[model samples]
Target: MAALCPNDFKPIGWLCRKKRYSLKWKLCISMIFVLMTSMWINPKLLMSMLTPVSEYKKQDITPVKNSKHLMVSAFKDHRINGSTRIISILNRGQLQPLFCIFCCGKNNYSTPATIDMHSDHFGFRYVTTDVLCRNKPKSNAMYVTLSLKPDVLYNLTDFLPIQNQIQEEEAFPYEFTICISSLFGSYNNVLQFVQTMEVYKLLGIQRVVIYNTSCGPDLEKVLHYYSEEGILEIVQWPIDQFLIPSRGWNFKEHGGDIHYYGQLTTLNECIYRNMYKSRYVLLNDIDEIIMPYQHANLHLLLEDLQQEHPNVGVFIIENHIFPKTQFDNSGQFNRTEWKKVPGINILEHVYREPDRKNVFNPTKILANPRQVVQTSVHSVLKNYGQTFRVPPDVCRIVHVRVPLQSNLTKEQLFVDKKLWEFEKPLLPNVDNVFKKTGFLN
Candidate 1:
């Protein structure tokens, strides 16, 4: 062999020097090679691997403790003013501090919430409260979670998706939506429910939103029927599961934790839930129907009333009681097919009790939801415009239930068959529902 020089072993020397590089540099080169190979194999797989995990991972936070004392119901984004309104039920006397934690991708921003207990708590321990949180600029938060501490871990609270963020104008999904809140006591009343629903259709009501805690089997069938028809939306209201709900409105008399099965809370929730969806929202019970005496349909009645009271947002209609005990003399609507139904026949009860002299008669409401901030069973607590008491001749709610004035006789009551005016269309519609639901087989 020829005499060996350093030049003869140059390739092996180069390889040895390259191996002397730092481990970090070696790993970097290896990663680059793997990434390039992955890209050639599947670009989407490489892109997904490079993307942040937070972008696709669903965040599930633990539900807060002591939810009964301070239960969060819903989150609404008040797009009109760019603020968030948190619907919650809190102890009226509770002094615990609450914070609104806004979730923005991987980060969270906390803000002190201004708790506004609704004035119509009715002396109950728990009340409907509005926890208002102002949106922070550039937070880009789409959901909110409630916590007692300002610096809560993102995984410690349940996230509520913010709703009602879309601002709608003239176009709306429903012209009139009837809101029946917190149906409890295993409410059945199949015949009356069907009658009322058909009457609502006659009155031009396009939607009926009911917060149901519990109902009997017959009523459930009726609810399912209307829901399948796309005319009713049932919101599951398991208030009793969370708190001791009262049977009556007054806390002292009713003797329970929350007033009237959290009726006020459901009413206000319905208002906000349907704010941008419905043009008008009528807050009343299933047994009561806002019957118009003068106009053929509710649309015309509202059209004229809105024209007259251009600045008014709420129109309070007097509630007249049609005692279920008294029936029409003719018994014209007491059809044999309906006798088996387990509810009062509203059509048969035509005589309404005379309005008590110099006493405050509780009224139901028909309001422009866009103008209402909060609502109660009888009236709107906070509104953007004037509240007008609609004339009795124009409209009134036909409330058929246990008589408030039980002393009145049939002869003493007024003969107001306003419901009969709707019988032509109402009866057949109700019959069809009953037939379809097999209530009358």
Candidate 2:
């Protein structure tokens, strides 16, 4: 070997003293080396480390829930998880995606499934979970909230989400109960309201559940009297403050926040509320009555119907429009006391508009509350048993309202005097209610 200089046998890349590099360059090289070593050691770990960055770059990691931290469904294969009951879509905003969550005991559901809902004209979607509880041992209750934003946590029972209990055999005081929804914003039709209630009573209904949003002071007094007497159950339905509910059933034409003032939700809720309690539930508007022509009362009609159709859970009563224009010409009896009332005396409106050919007549229902899963304005949306449309001869809806169709001649209309049978008792009953509510001084 030759005599060694100060830098003899130095590396080709090194300088006389030592190789120099900027701190940034050194750090970069070191990071690259570490990354390569890490990838070599475990490629999955490296990919995992980079995944967040990749997701961030794509901006796809949006949290599932919003800031309100409402409850949302979690995916889990719980062996004992049950079904959902009365699953109506709560609300779907333009910014938030719709959610179908579990809010009942695990025994309620038969199988795990996703519910689908579509929008009305305004693009509002609705979906509800459907399944009866199994009521098996070891089943637990669960609640889920559908938050508008992603990845937000809501308190349990914050919204009092659906809770499907085991359907116990509860003894309901009423053999027949009526459910009416969203009576909002100081509404008053005293005559019609009294007439409807009297008719319901005459038809053997023992209880009426009204989800009252707001009512006229006079109507409130009547409602209060009914409430105190235990004839009516009033649910405080202040839906306007919470939501922009729709005024009409058809969302496009009416353009409301909810459909017909959240009637569907309330109807579903009423079915569940009276599920085990009442033997049957009658769904109709205050102006409509499911008038039985052949049978003396609904109890008898239902008894005969049950005997004929053993498995039928729903009885759909056809709607007949009794235009307010028609009045009883026969001077058999005068509603002398009711003359001062604001609404048409139902007794006087006997003529019904003829059913147009190929037209969809809106219907009302007499349903076994236990078997009803979902409902709409006209008919049962879902049920546990068969649904049968009762013939017009046996029974039909005595819907007293303005004529839906135009250009009807007197000859075209037919007289439906079915409501007359109950008139004698109904008149007295109305007078008594008015007297009791202090409507008639």
Candidate 3:
């Protein structure tokens, strides 16, 4: 048995045990090879198990600040007719949703606008008005904010609706400019013009904007004189050259191209025309004046009012209609020299009709050009800052027009002495303007 099994050194049971141990080692090696292949295929799955959930989340959501280079080049507040438009530029071409957040009173709502594609990196984009109502919006003192990105937001500087209505192209350098709309060739009120302008000068007004359509020969002379003086900015408003403008503001009755010879357009244009040049704008007719009762000039009056109510941008001055029917009997200022001038002497019309019950006294405004957006003949249509009803005591509109209400007599009308306070300078100033313009000669 020893000679036959000389090649084999171990017994049968020992050989069988060695073979079984060898099989166990082979199984272990095969399992390790399968595991190595699985690990190579799904390495992230193993890492996920090892890493914490919060850390993974933090790494995933890393916000890119100021990544969206959205810009606003031009903006307009069309709230006068319940519309707002924003012109912007977007650098990135991705389809990112943008929102224009309007902050007004307690309401903060966002309206979506588009960023259109263009050839240039700085493309021109537009955002139209999202108005829900036919009438004016709930608040006038409003501002704009832009939001789209997760980390970046743009808060525009506090701009009033007035500033948004037009482009600041024709700006002037005057403290105050009176915007007299639609001077439709009427030179019938020379005396009224003289008085109104004189009072304006006393009130610290530096310039007057007249949208002239036509005028009397003599009136043209005065206008030319004022124009040469660099005090009057005359805009040759040839509305008839373009459209059949309305004869009056009543479009429903006397319909035309625009109401009252494009009066609305003229007023809006005047505001934009003098937006940068003038600090304050007084919107009224040539017959009207925002007269201060307690203070001497507009500067003092505004200083006091602004100090008290700092946030108010538009001051709605109440229009006190001093009917041309009533004349001062005391003979304070002689108007015999102005008889040939062909206009009413405002100095004589000291009697104002008493405000009747349920009757609204038409109002005018002395507004901050930067604060106002849209203006009507009587009042401000839209504004950026708060509007305030100026107290009658502080200042009010001296509207020397024909009586709107009937059955009001001398006794019924109240005599306001505010005009008399400026008589010292007003009298000489009127004469000087007349003489300087060659009306007195």
Give the lowest summed-lDDT range of ten residues in model 3. Answer: 121-130
**Among all candidates shown, the one with the greatest lDDT:** 1
Candidate 1 per-residue lDDT, tens place, 205-270, comes to: 999999889999989998999999999999888777767899998888988888898888888888
lDDT of each: 0.81, 0.65, 0.64
Poorest lDDT segment (10 consecutive residues) of candidate 1 = 53-62
For residues 131-245, write the lDDT of model 3, one tens digit per residue: 1212135545244444563232222232223234444435646878889886775655788887888778888999999988888877787788778988898877665664466
Cα lDDT tens digits for candidate 2, 9-121: 44443433444677999999999999899789877656544443223212101122433111211221122354443233433433234343333432222233343332232
Winner by TM-score: 1
Q: TM-score for candidate 1, please give it.
A: 0.85
What ranking of all candidate models by TM-score puts the best one first? Answer: 1, 2, 3
Off by over 4 Å in 1: 1-68, 75-80
- List ranges where model 3 is wrong by over 4 Å: 1-172
